[model samples]
Target: MIRARVGARDAMRILTEVARANGQIFEALGVSKSSVSRKAASDQFLSRSESERILGLAKLIGQVQSMTNDAEADAPAWLATWMAEPVPALGGERPINLIGTMEGQTVVSNMLGHVLRGGFA
Candidate 1:
């Protein structure tokens, strides 16, 4: 579904930007930075699953930005902190550790929703 709306280059750009903002290497997302560059150069689309993961990450980033009332420029650091820090609601698991799977994304998203609604995350 995300692939229908987002091109590979755009997804890679977003992923790369997020990784840089988080002070992390692209491999943290399970793909090498060179692979993303190669795909961009070739105009190849990301796999459906990869697209989903990127989209999920983008959504989470957006939510964090909205919640913080911070400029987009400030969002990456905030998101990185939030993801890397352990969450009591998640049984002390860092949010980033669970974001690679759909179920985990749902859990993170739901927690954000609760936070937005003024409930404990």
Candidate 2:
């Protein structure tokens, strides 16, 4: 629930661990560093849009990781590297760059699905 803010911090932690990601990722996902820190310091909640985007980031990470089928120990670094790499299917845009918006997530997700189905990514 947005009212409680339970997902904000956890989502951030997930991004940090899985992608070695930071404020750039958060900002791209529409959460400013100052806002996250300020709300965290006050033990307050993120705005609905911020919480939604962060949660979406968390979900995207899970989806990517599942597609990888890599060992658990390898997943973090693998995801970080994969996210940074550019894809021709995305006009040479890095997956990480586009993952901030819902539309981009859809594109990335569909690309992964394509790869899973033995199509090019």
Q: Which one wins on lDDT?
A: 1
| lDDT measured at residue 28 in model 2 versus the true structure, 0 to 100 | 61
Q: Each prediction's Cα lDDT score? A: 0.72, 0.65
Q: Write the per-residue lDDT of candidate 1 for residues 1-121, one digit (tens) a residue.
A: 7647456698777876677656452544555567667888889877777777778888887887777775645666667766777788889887787777778888988877786668875
Once fitted onto the true fold, the runs of candidate 2 whose alpha carbons sit more than 4 angstroms away are 1-7, 18-23, 69-71, 74-76, 116-118
Q: What is the C-alpha RMSD of each candidate to the true structure, in Å?
A: 2.6, 2.8
**Model 2, TM vs. native:** 0.74
Top TM-score prediction, candidate number: 1
What TM-score do all the candidates reach, one by one? 0.78, 0.74
Cα misplacement distance, residue 117 of candidate 2 (Å): 5.3
Give one digit per residue, the lDDT tens place, for model 2 in 4-111.
554445654665675353335765666666666666667676777667666666666666668767556455455456667788888888877877778887887787
Candidate 1: deviation at residue 88, Å? 1.7
